[model samples]
Target: MNNIVSMAWVKEHMGEPNVVIADCRFVLGKPDAGREAYEASHIPGAVYLDLEKDLSAPVDEHGGRHPLPDIFDLTVALSLAGIGNETKVVAYDDQGGAMASRLWWLLKYLGHEHVYVMDQGFAAWTSAGHPVTDEIAEPTPVKFLAIVEHTMLVEMDQVQELLGREGVTLIDSRETPRYRGEVEPIDRVAGHIPGAINRFWKDGLTVTGSWKVADEQAERFADLDKNRELIVYCGSGVTATPNVIALQEAGFTNVKLYAGSWSDWISYSENPVATGDEENA
Candidate 1:
């Protein structure tokens, strides 16, 4: 299936055994509110993937806030949710694919490339007049085998090398406020990595909440040399994923993600932090 599927496409093939719909709605403020909404209503056969409980591992001083969970633990969770190696995962969320992109990236890192995020997410599904069910989908166990692709992840040392290195593009996916060090909401450090460019993840979408067309998305990166090594990161590495999708859609290859992102960078006092309105530096 395509990386971003339509509601009509889902409605047609949703009942297929290999098809698995996953709801990834998450609100940072109200941690459990997403599950509550899922219980109230979701697309039929959609299983919930909690951001903190499922998407992230135990946080510590070394790892960022949303470290990748253990492969064994994630595999067990995926098995319980009926996600096999061959399963086609369709992930969705209300936040313009912000939350759902985490699931998409995880599946890609696991070397399972048959996963996708719904454009406009649950909002589009409901807007299309699709029926929602309150009944919880029964867990159908499947043997999920995951092989982590290290190419999709980068460590602090690697990031350090890219700080002033040419031929590489480091993208900071946080908003202008955080990137500029004007406001410190979540982490100890308020600024971004030195020499990184700010490209807020939400900019990949339209005002209507759906992802921008590929050509429109390409325009956002027109200034960049596509031949360069592209690395994307955000707070805890969650929001940076949509840009990965956008980049891929726009046909820019050789992309990697700094999974620990700004959070992990700030954890080390030695890492220099950049602050200002500089979109690219």
Candidate 2:
């Protein structure tokens, strides 16, 4: 199934027995903003999922700022959101799919294959004259068992081992400045992982802010070998997911996410960092 769905498709499938819409809007610094937006107005029958609470675990010294949520806890959250094993979930956010793609990646990592990210997000949905509701949805709770796709993730240690390895490509999905080590805003270290290439996640979108078509996505990464293993990462692992999805859309089958990402990479002072567009050996 395609990783992204359109607003019309979501609108068409609303209230279906097996279809669930999730409001995943989140502001990085404002913890409660997403829920507040949802409470103010959202797609009818949509359930809210917080990026920090439902999608990620508490931050620690080693793991990235947004560590993957505990599998058991995440499963329970999904169950409470009325997402069964067979449910078709559509996730959306106002942050250019950054927040929603995190949930999409998490669900896929948990072995759920029927999930998708909605295109253009909540703002487009609202601006296009779609129905919105202040009333919260009360979905019937159901069991959501996680099978766990371990192959989808790569830890910091695994990332270290893959450095400079042939047939493997580490992609830094942050902006050019961050990748080049020209500025350090969020993390202590500014440079990217040694031997990694830059592929800003936002480039996957069109000028109008919609996800690019598969052909367009393929064009975006035309220089890379599709057969090679592509491992993607961002500041805290949240933004890298869109690049993961973009790679999949571009017909790359072998892709993985470095869940700990740059934040975790920088935690160990011994880890080497590269700067200024140099893919250090």
Each candidate's root-mean-square deviation in Å?
1.3, 1.2
Clashes of 2: 0
TM-score of each: 0.97, 0.98
Pairs that clash in candidate 1: none
Scored by lDDT, the top model is 2
Q: Model 1, range 1-281, lDDT digits (tens) per residue?
A: 45798887888878799999999999987999999999999999899999988988988897688888888888899999999999999999998898889999998999897999887888678878898999999968999888989888889999897777879889888898998899989998898888888888899988888788889889998898888999999999899999999998887988999989889988998888889865453
Looking at model 2, report the run of 10 residues with the lowest lDDT sum. 272-281
lDDT of 1: 0.88
- Residue 151 displacement in candidate 2 (angstroms): 0.6
What digit string (tens of lDDT, one per residue) describes model 2 on residues 1-281?
69999999999999899999999999989999999999999999999999999999999998999999999999999999999889999999999999999999999998999999999999999899999999999999999989999999999999889888899989999999999999989999999999898999999999878999999999888888978888999999999999999999999999999988999999999999999885422
Model 2 RMSD vs true structure: 1.2
